[model samples]
Target: MPAWRRIRSLRVRWLVATLAAMAVALVLAGLFLHSLFQDQVMRQHESALTLQLDQLTARLEFDASGQASIDPATLSDPRWGKPYSGLYWQLDEVGAAPESQGAQRSRSLWDDRLHPEPDSPADGQIHVHQGTGPRGVPLLLVERTVFSAETPARHWRLVVAGDLTEVGDASARFARVLTLSLLALGVLLALAALAQVAVGLAPLRALQRALTDLREGRSQRLQGAFPAEVQPLIDDFNGVLDRNAEVVERARTQAGNLAHALKTPLAVLDQAAAPSVTADPAALAALVHEQVTLARRHIDWHLKRARVAAAQRLPGHRTPLAPVVDGLLRVLARVHDARHLDLGADDMPADWAFAGEEQDLQEMLGNLMDNACLWARTRVHVAAQREGDRLVITVEDDGPGIAPEQRQAVLARGVRLDEATPGSGLGLAIVADLAALYEGSLSLDDAPSGGLRARISLPATR
Candidate 1:
């Protein structure tokens, strides 16, 4: 199989899917958290720069020539006096060229001047921008346009620019920490998922071992209790094993029985072939015929039982009871037409069906109805009804019925109540055996019409 097709393992499938989802979710969560942190940090940086800008505006001094200056000692922050201290302030003409000379600036600016993006801010309105400062360091610039009363005609832009290196460093450190934390969390969650998959599928592993035991003949059936989720499957498999054993046992028994049944005929034939035996040709032929017929009967009986047993295991064997009964009644009516016997079936629903092969049903019902016709004086009645999951069929005849004590004996193989009735004495026995194969029962009861009632209860489909 291809590599993809080989991924039929349920455990592998679940783990891969779970890990993939966790990875995506953790990555997204890390990104969202980092973005939020960056925004808050940027907001705080802007607010600090705005405060410095406000102080610079309030302490500004302009000469009569509209030149602006500030008292360095007046600023409380010591960084304003330190060169390249990352915090700086400068003043510029509103629409001057980038390098306007004599523009007042803080000592922190040193030789480099702040070049903020050109923007016409309304009076007292602050605007923020990103710019570069000394040594190509990134800076966040917060600027405001101011009109001093000392130099109202000459508006100067007051700007405070702070180096963003520290903020970038802080954010980088936070990103690294967040990544490590989320990776750790993902690892823990993955381990948890792995453990859960192992625990959840443990029952399947047990089931596999049980199957191996059964296959190896270490046990007769699957053994051991399982989780509720897997218990039903275990039960069904065990049931199948039991049924298979039953089939094997039945086959063995039937073989032995058939052998035992044929032993007498075979021995008789063996004795007849002896040199010491002296018999006329007609007598010899008659004896051979009788023994051959008896062997054939035993063979047919075992074969019918085997066929029914095999059919019992198969599914979807629905034979409508009404149709089979009708067909059998038609056949038996003609077979016993000389007696002018009343052979008919009681009113049964057309949907009443037997859960077995049609041939098996025919064999069972045919034997019963045929026996009833033989002994019936005036009427042979066949009726069926549904009792829960069972199909109850009763064949009754209005004639001299067998005694209650002889009913069970009559169902035994080759047990005929009346030898004068002219039968192989296997009809009722076959019916009883066939019914038993279907997990059904054959019973003899007193019919309302004062005849022997052969009642059969077989599994039904509808």
Candidate 2:
């Protein structure tokens, strides 16, 4: 049950396989034990028959009448008890009737009808059968044919029987013993299997402890002994940690370079204005404002890049895209309040996600929507939806559409296609940079509203 978590593991599967194989071996061992015990029972039964035969051999003798007879008194013995008293013997001379030997013999011989079947082999060894005896007690019977060495005419068959009840009782007891023993063995094997599973999973528990230590900020890398089978997995995990650290360092370096690269131009543009003219409230303020806005745009672009880098290393609940785009339209409406434009966020699937940092998403959509607000005279529409593995956000307004040749130049850094346009023209360039940072893209196209449509696409993740 503990293994049923989302972090699926192969350890449980391996343990189950080991248990199954052990179970098979135990079953086979029980079978072997049964076979060995059964063979022992058969040998004891044959030994009883051989002992009865040996006694009859000494008792067999010729009387003065020249007839064969057995001394019945010899049948009684201390070692030979109840069921062994069930033995029978028959002796017949040439052309004469048969005579019984034992007092407690089968009543079958009493019938004088007690006759050995001809089907018995001449070699005379133990043969198993079921036949009625004198008392009508069902019997498990053993028979043997015999020959006398002194007289060839003495060809006799010795048939032995024991009560079926005694044999059946003995077998039942043996079976009960075997069953109980096998059951005990199965329980012991099951416990052994459980212990093997625990021993085998010990490494996994150690690995978990190591990872927990890492989460508590105690260790940066896991180093512990593990079975050779898991060595590759540990090595691969270490490699991932190393790569993540490298990516973090590279992101910081690139962020610093971006800040330094854009500051020099803003400095020069500021120095170009004279101090007396810069002191003029209207004209100099406008010049300073434009340059400050350009510098802010560069800063925002790099900041978005840094946020995207951080989010890649640690993903959480997906950032909702519909609300982010909607919020941007509302703020853009407030920014261009004087124009009195009607901005509506088009309905999109609410579950669409951007999968990047929430603030970076806000910056990307805010810049695009603000640009739409700047150019539109009456209406601006923003919407986002998914296509395949990408989520596409499009902002459209009823403004002059970009000429086919000018669309490419509009995305270039510091390339303002329209000089009369009030701003520094870095908005589109910054949007393009942020898009690239998240492995996304931005494109310019004709809008259905008779204006430019800025479409931005970001990779979709669940």
Candidate 3:
């Protein structure tokens, strides 16, 4: 089939939908958690920078010329004295000439001056921003404007900054771990979804097997207690089977009643036209006899057709081939004993069964074996075997076989061969018709023993 159709199956659709939903949820959660963690980390980093700026403001001093400077000796972190330690402090003279450079900054700044934006914070207020620090590294800067005691007339922009590369590395590491963990969880959940689908739909698989058994004649109805969700379906199917069996039984009774009803009148007509009635009644009696016989034959033919068609669909019909063949051989052997015919049936597997009623089996096999016995010079052999879902039965004899060209013609009802054989020519025709009703076939071919071989094929028990 096509790829789309295969994917559209219930199990596949269930697994896809569940896994898709989980993946989306995991992705969104990962993003939200990562953003929350980054925000908290940045907040903590800013608080530390604020504390360092406060200390820098405390350490602010001026030389004898009113120039603001920081006493590096008073700072707690030794990195403030180390160049490019990723932690630095700087002071810029505000409200000074645009061309004037800032006051001396912490030793860590070296030649790189802290560039405070023109919009500096109000006196004693703080402004936090991210910008380039010494050596072009990213920094989180906290700047505060203060009028130092020694230089009270001028506002100095005091700044303390820390490098952000370490924090960024930490965040990146966290994101990678979070993604891997969530992906692992998703894989586990996908497998759980598959298992859930299989468990949830297990009843459906059981129901399918039960139906198959019913069709194959291994069971009469759906057997086992199903879940409540599926119990009603099984009940309805069993009800349908029961009703179908009832209907077929009714049809069988009606066909039997019809045969008896019609045959009685036909027999009466034949009796009424008997030669004992009058010497001149020969011609009239012959005509009446012929018509009565035709009516009876037609009635029997149609009744059997109707009965077979009705019973073919009813469930729980299995006839063992070996038993039926054995019975037929015993009866026919006695019936044709005076002809000294060698009649026997080959052993077939015990499980070899025709998927139909016993009467139908008897009917088909009887006609074939009887025809073989009638024409056989000495021996009539019968054998049966199973071929896949079909049963194959062969009846062969050593008598003169029908010519290939005329074989097809003999299958027609009332078309007797060899006027002296004393048959209505309906045996093979009836067998063929019954086999066709069972969705089977019958064929005539040359036998291994120089006689005709009649092969019948019918649906077998699964």
Candidate 4:
């Protein structure tokens, strides 16, 4: 894949997105902080100049002629006495002729006069401006108009000009420091984002490793502790693995059972066909027919098991208990009409449905109800109800019941309790195996009517 397409990894995507957002935030924050710092620095500088203007105004002495003069020595700052020392003060008469000089200036101005931008200020109010100072140095000027009663017809403008080189240097240094600080912060935040993405996705990494182990046959199922957010997915995958393993085991067992079951019938057929075992033709034919029937029964039993096993995992399968039970009861009532057995189903909710193939449910219930009808004297009752996510079905008969110890044996293949009981002894076994394939169970218990009770639990669906 191309490099851009390769960016589909979640870790890379999260890191890139987080770092980009942090970068933008840090850049904006840096700009805002720098602007605040510059404003504060300029305000402090202007305040200092305003204080100088106030002191210069305070020292002004006007003769009775309204000529403004100031003694430079009275100023506390020594820079006022040095020429071009980056700090200076001057006085100008308001509305004076452009060529006339009626004011005294600080010696720091030397032979150059402070020609600030023309602006009018109210008396005692300071107005700041930017202008060129001695030697063309950039300057911040704080100017204020003063009115003295000693010269009622005239107002004096006192100005303090300071060089901006120092402020410029300070601002530049601040910008450099702020840039470095934000860059460092961005780097640190990026690292933290990377770490967070790694920590958050660690469970997925562990899951990948577990899948690798399972694929390589190192483990039977996905096995590990994960975060709560990911544990459900892990559990579901493990469940799938468990079910697959069970299917494989069931297939192997069915093959073995089928082979073992057909062995006796096939051996008998082979003996009847042997040359030294010649017998009457009719007897031999009957023997072959019986053996073939037994073999076919075993085959059919294994085929049914395989079919149920395959359909057990299918989704969205629903068979209502009411209809299947009612249908089976009606069919059995006629099949056992000679005995006049009362075959009937109890009233069950129509919504009580099995979570499996309808045919499999029919097969299981058919075997159970038929076996009940065979043992029933006059009454066989089928009952079904929902218990949580399971459907419980019971088949009861009012006849001679087997001892508790023998009930289990009756559910084993070909383990007939009585040879006189006309059956292949596979009915109860098939029902038990079918129930097991659907992750259900079958048990033989005592009925309320003093007969056998066969109860089966199957998965239910709403």
Quote each prediction's TM-score. Answer: 0.89, 0.51, 0.56, 0.82
Candidate 1 weakest ten by summed lDDT: 95-104
* Model 1 TM: 0.89
lDDT tens string, model 1, 1-462? 578765997888999999999999999999999999988999999999998888888898878888777888899999998999999998888877666832788999988888888779998899999989999999999998887676678888888999999999989999999999999999999999999999989888888998899889899988998988888988898898889899999999999999999999999999998999999999999999999999998898889788788879688889888989999988887888889998888899978999999988998899998898889899999888899999999999998999999998999888898889988788888888888899999999898999889999999995
The deviation in Å at residue 357 for candidate 2 is 3.3
Q: lDDT tens digits, residues 215-296, model 2?
A: 8989988889989998899899989988788777867787786768667756766575646433556766677777777677
Clashing pairs in 2: 107-134
Instruction: Rank candidates by lDDT, best first.
Output: 1, 4, 3, 2
**Pairs of residues at least 3 apart in sequence or in different chains that clash in candidate 3:** none
Best by TM-score: 1
The regions of model 3 sitting more than 4 angstroms off are 1-5, 61-68, 148-153, 277-462
Select the stronger candidate by lDDT from 1 and 3: 1
Q: Which ten residues in a row have the lowest lDDT in candidate 2?
A: 99-108
Candidates 3 and 4 compared: the better one by TM-score is 4
Off by over 4 Å in 4: 1-6, 62-69, 90-122, 131-136, 149-156, 181-213, 218-236, 275-293, 334-341, 418-422
As a whole number from 0 to 100, the lDDT of residue 443 in candidate 2 is 96
User: In order, how many clashes per candidate?
Assistant: 0, 1, 0, 0
Q: What lDDT tens digits, residue by residue, belong to model 3 across residues 1-462?
A: 789897878877888788889989999999999999899889999999999888777777777667778767788898878888888887778877755654567788887877756685778998988998777889998989887566578877778888999889989999999999998988898888888999998998998899899989999999976899899988998998887797678677667756765776677676676777654568667767776777777777777878798789678999888999999999999999899999887878888899999999999999999999999999999987778999999999999999999999989876898889878788998999899889999999999989999999999987
- Candidate 2 or 1, higher TM-score: 1
Model with the higher TM-score, candidate 2 or 3? 3
- TM-score of model 2 vs. true structure: 0.51
- How far does residue 124 in candidate 3 sit from its true spot (Å)? 3.5
